[model samples]
Target: MKITDMTSECIGKCLNYLSFDDLLRAAISNKKLNNAANLIYEQKYRSKRVEMHILSRLHSNYFMTENRFCFYSLRTSFQFLFCFGRQVNEIHISYIPRYVIPGENGVQNENNVELTHRAIDYANDYCAESLRTIKFTRIQDASRYMKRPFINLENLEFYDCNFTDLVEYNLLNALFPKVQKLVLKTINKNLDQPCTLKFIEGRFAHLKSLHIESNSYSKFHHADEYCILKGNLVTAFRLNPQLKELDLDLFVNCHVFQSNDVLLVINYLQNLDSLSLAIDDTFCSLLDSSVPPLMYFRNLKKFSLNMQLSTESRAIQFTSHQLDTFELHGVDRFTNYEYEFLEKHPTITKLILRGGHFERLNLSRIAAALPILEQLMIFDHFKLKIEEIVPHWSKFQSLKLLCFFHTKIVKDSDLKPLLINGWHGRFCNSPNKFQIILKR
Candidate 1:
């Protein structure tokens, strides 16, 4: 039958199976095919295309001309958004010039400021209506333009952005009144004071997840910085008591946070289901002290710690019965205290260990303790002889997923038994085959 004789349903079904590039090519073959391609493109292809178009312009100076729309500059990119922004669900603004020349006392230059203001205006006017997620990186004051509430925005992220003044902070709170997920990375070292959430109480009532990271590695060198960060965290938790997940990495190093401060924060986070703390202090003291028991985290299902605890504090016990996932880091050796702690969490089915010194005996101990563990991830910096450790696999009958990151395999033949079922980096042994992943 001739192509024109095919029904529209048949054409659409055939076009749906074609790859995007192939559909574009097929569109030019005939008028019938062109109409079919356009129908499919409008329904399934347009949104992703617009998102990529906007991202490409923001990340690079590359330009593309399509359908009489030219995206040669940042201005034209906004113009593209003005027409098709509804198709874009997420927006990322990588860098906004500070408009201040170095060595000029940080005074704002009128010319550059005008350019930034115009870009911000275009972004706000065109894209804010439909964006669900917005990320800003290296922006001097993104809150200046984002002061208005974004009705549709649910996820917001800021990396190396300045909120130096109360006005900026207030604007930020107003910008995403309905945000459910927020990620903040404080890396600007020039700020006189660290960002704090003391003024925004009851503002993030709907927020469910919060992640704060101190991208400034140098901040750990100063003791006072940790105090400031801890204060900020306390205030943040108080303001968002409804949060279900909290991840904090303030670049804290040994002896930064006292045992009391850590317990205080944990007490406030009873509602959290997942908690990741990267404070570089010893949890041993907290466990040994009269502070509330680990049972304070009643609802916590997943816990991650990247700290060093004294092996001397062997009396520590974790009684969070609901916890199913446990992650430990910065452990060079598996001491008796550590083993004792894991012995209490026999219900844990997922475990991740990083920067840990793991020997055959340690693996055997973990397998014996967490017999039902289904997923295991080990990120070791030191070289590991997988050949010598393969014999231990028999102990992990419940393990279904095993992953290794940044670990050097001493021998390639060690993976031969696991790879027998599949050569594509995935292997299954038999009735209870498990997947193994090794990353260098």
Candidate 2:
């Protein structure tokens, strides 16, 4: 029905599916509909207090109030409590100028001291008592704001802010006091040109999940070097005892510590059930042959490692008897040592192998080792002697998804039964169909 014919019941149902903005637009065309929709939107989607600031107003009299609805500052802080309006549950502030690097186009970049204070005030006033998740940004010096620790925030994220310098220690120390999930991005590994493990022990003690990514690969490498010398990486694993998931990718050339050093750091992270480790040649070589004593991650389910495997040495040696889902990259040369390693534990059900020459691979040996293997992915061209083990393929009857890329033997005639029953994935030789053949 048209707007005139529609009743309040019809409008309420319609607005339920429309976003606040869309509903507002629809209401503007009809006063009765607008009045009814406004009430519902405010009751459901609208926050009791909404605050937005483009600049700090810390010096202004507006912030002096003991309790207020919304407080925002581009200079200082809007000091207000949430009691005035349910404790300002959501606060969003952006500092885009800090992103403009100092020397870029000769822009003289200086610290926005006033703005920094304003940000800390918002976090303290809005998030200290009742806020659920507060996202803070444009923090040139997160350290100063994070010092007092009045926050009970559950989720915290920092963009283009450095949190590792001694100057910022108080800031990190303050932020993670009660935060459950913490994320950092596009920030300096070295706050002031020197590498620092800014949050190893002081911050994130209560963190359950941690995710860090560098905007530039080179900068991340710079951070890795700092972590190694200061033992920051090791200390991080030890500090977050309650941490359950970790995703870290270092960009710079990492310093290769002894295997014991690596184990010393990882063993402390026994609580980690989902782990993703992405290292380059320098770091992977360190873990080549040495296997860290598996700390009991009884709940461990998914484990992935993306690092270069040195032909001279195995890139990583994982000996977890509990690991179920496994993905490895840069592991080819199927040496006897690598083969024996897998033979010892064949319980893994899913496997993904990337970037390796399998010319030396023994199909029979692999099938014997992992009799229960179900899903396999090989993403690289390798010389495979499939003819040798065609008859023994019965062992792989349990296989479900098999993928081959750029292999020498695409359609081996002897492998007919396995192809029809299992889902065969391969590159199509023509646009019409995938180039896969079965044995007669």
Candidate 3:
């Protein structure tokens, strides 16, 4: 049975079983294998997602034949788009300064601005119809390219980008009127002059998700910055009234947000299915207050709360009958009342508890509360004997996966109960779903 005597289907099946690197190595062995490898490579990567970093110099022949390319540089990106525009679906452009000093005689260089304009013109001319998403990072003059229309672009993300003024910020709404998802992170270099979201005046009618975050941590910001951020947030809520999912991690300190402001924002969001809020102790106090009821978020199916400070009085209530996923982080302790809240929300099938202090009793309470939980992740500050907690495992009727990170197991017999109960255990492992991690 010589290799060449095998049928084409058998040979292909053999090649398909080989890893990509092995296939390339086999290609070097013979002409028949080389042809097969080329066919496989093209079939695998031709229409796959492509990312190209176009920083320094332009290479003429570099990505002329690739498809679905995500370009990072300005001039080279424009050239690549000019050549293979129809094949591209996503593009990322980051401005790389060529000068030794950023500013010349107190005025920033305009050459980068001009290059950006040219890139925008190229994108508009060549790939406007096929492009689906565009991301701009570390951009100085964002308004220059943002003023142009991207006909079919559905997603836009900005990271560490600068917007000089409110007018430039508003130009984003005008640039991609049909955009469905928008993500903005660290939008300003000067914390004193943070990009204001107050000007976002309901421009995106089709937007389904909006994510906004600041570069500065909540504890380090000044009073004035918090004031501006809060005002801008209120304005954002008013502008995008039809959003279905909102992720806000801007204000790290709860003191920055008043109880009424929190109520106003949550109440304004009518049909949201998912909400993620990262706040400090003061905001948690507001949730425990009577004014803004938890009923405001009763329609959410997925909810995440990342607390900044540890407090025993922390209370949060979710009356959402449809909520199937719940995540809580950075809280030190879960009181009996809080556990009771969880017991009421049996609809939650996926629960993630991170950075919380939990003993055997607390773990038992959690297992008893959410009997229908399918996926559970407990990371950091969880100290208990596995044998002591296993007695409560019978309560988890629907659990399929369990994970522990940086957890301490006090006794060797801690895992003996799990092995007896048909649960697999793994220690110091990597990337396996059915394994339970224990740190002795």
Candidate 4:
């Protein structure tokens, strides 16, 4: 079929794979392509993309030779807003630089604030019913722009807020209480001031996934004063205990003085399907306990442990039907325990070890231990070897991806078992066997 005769729907689906600039270029020259690109952009309106869209307006230096009727290239944005604004799924407000009038040179502060507020007004008037996500990136003051919250907003994200004044959850909740997926990253707060919001039974009625973190690991913000993880989490936990996918590791310390606190938080959410947390001190108190508390996560199918310190436990062991995906990140000294634990969990389909104990991480043993293991990823420093289990190379019956990233291999010859007898990395003797990946 000729490209011109193709339906706009098909052309729009094709645009999904292309980058933004490419998509616009592909759409502008062709009539069908233009319609298709416009239709697709309505659905994929992520805030990051919105921010770029704003900048593209200001710094779009090259003179345009394409069709002026095109949605993005229209003479003025009002043409697109009047026609398609209501269909867009997200509203983006990223502290945009206001328009420079025909005669103006530099930015006018009063004009910019009015312009920013006008965009918010446009969102509140047109996209109120459809807008489900609103993202604020490095927004210092939202008072001028945040005139009203979209009642239907389901996701809200605040990124790089550590560089600006922190927005209290109470005020944010009042704005987006029904948000299901909320991400608060790198938020700088004053711990000395007392919180004014009274306890509410369930402030977040629709919350399902919550990611609250302190500053990103750039400077570590090293001082305790900058840490948000040390605060009282009792109110937030009690209010949103039903969250299914929880990642609080952002700043909560799970080390020397805060180990019990971490365990207590986990114990409260026994029904979580996935949990990701960070550890500061050690893994001994929890992993070395007579009864590892992590095992008690009966409903937890996926667990990611980000260890800031070394994993000092001797051996790890757990046998559960529900527990499958396990990821351990950090410098680990306990390979014997990982081996023991892997052998016990046949249900584990995805395993990621960011920190592996050298020499003891036997690929042959892992192939033998995990029967249904589909994806295996290793990162950082690691030494892997394949020993007696080489003879049973076909043991990797259901294996798929075995990846090694940034891992230093001590003995290269130990990998010979994978090549011998045309084994092809000692994979399953099937057409759909796993691939052994070696990455720097």
* TM values, all candidates: 0.70, 0.60, 0.73, 0.63
Question: Which regions of candidate 1 deviate over 4 angstroms?
Answer: 1-46, 49-72, 96-114, 168-171, 187-193, 198-200, 215-232, 254-258, 265-267, 282-295, 308-319, 359-361, 387-391, 405-440
Selected candidate, larger lDDT, 3 vs 4: 3
Over 272-370, each residue of candidate 3 has an lDDT whose tens digit, in order, gives: 889888776666566765754664565788988877765563556545777889888777667765687688787889888877776544667777778
Stretches of model 3 off by over 4 angstroms after superposition = 1-54, 57-75, 96-121, 187-192, 217-229, 254-256, 282-295, 310-313, 357-361, 406-416, 420-422, 429-440
Q: For model 1, what is the error of residue 344's alpha carbon versus the real structure, in angstroms, after optimal superposition?
A: 1.0
Q: What is the lDDT of residue 180 in candidate 1?
A: 93
Query: Distance from true position, residue 438, model 4, in Å?
Result: 9.4
- Candidate 1 residue lDDT tens string, 179-226: 899888876766445554333444576789988776454435576656
What's the count of clashing pairs in each model shown?
0, 14, 1, 3
- Every model's Cα RMSD, please? 9.1, 9.7, 9.4, 9.4
Candidate 3 yields a Cα-based lDDT of: 0.65
Q: What is the lDDT, from 0 to 100, of the residue 374 in candidate 3?
A: 85
- Give the Cα lDDT of each candidate: 0.63, 0.55, 0.65, 0.55
lDDT of candidate 2?
0.55
By summed lDDT, which 10 consecutive residues of candidate 3 come out lowest? 56-65
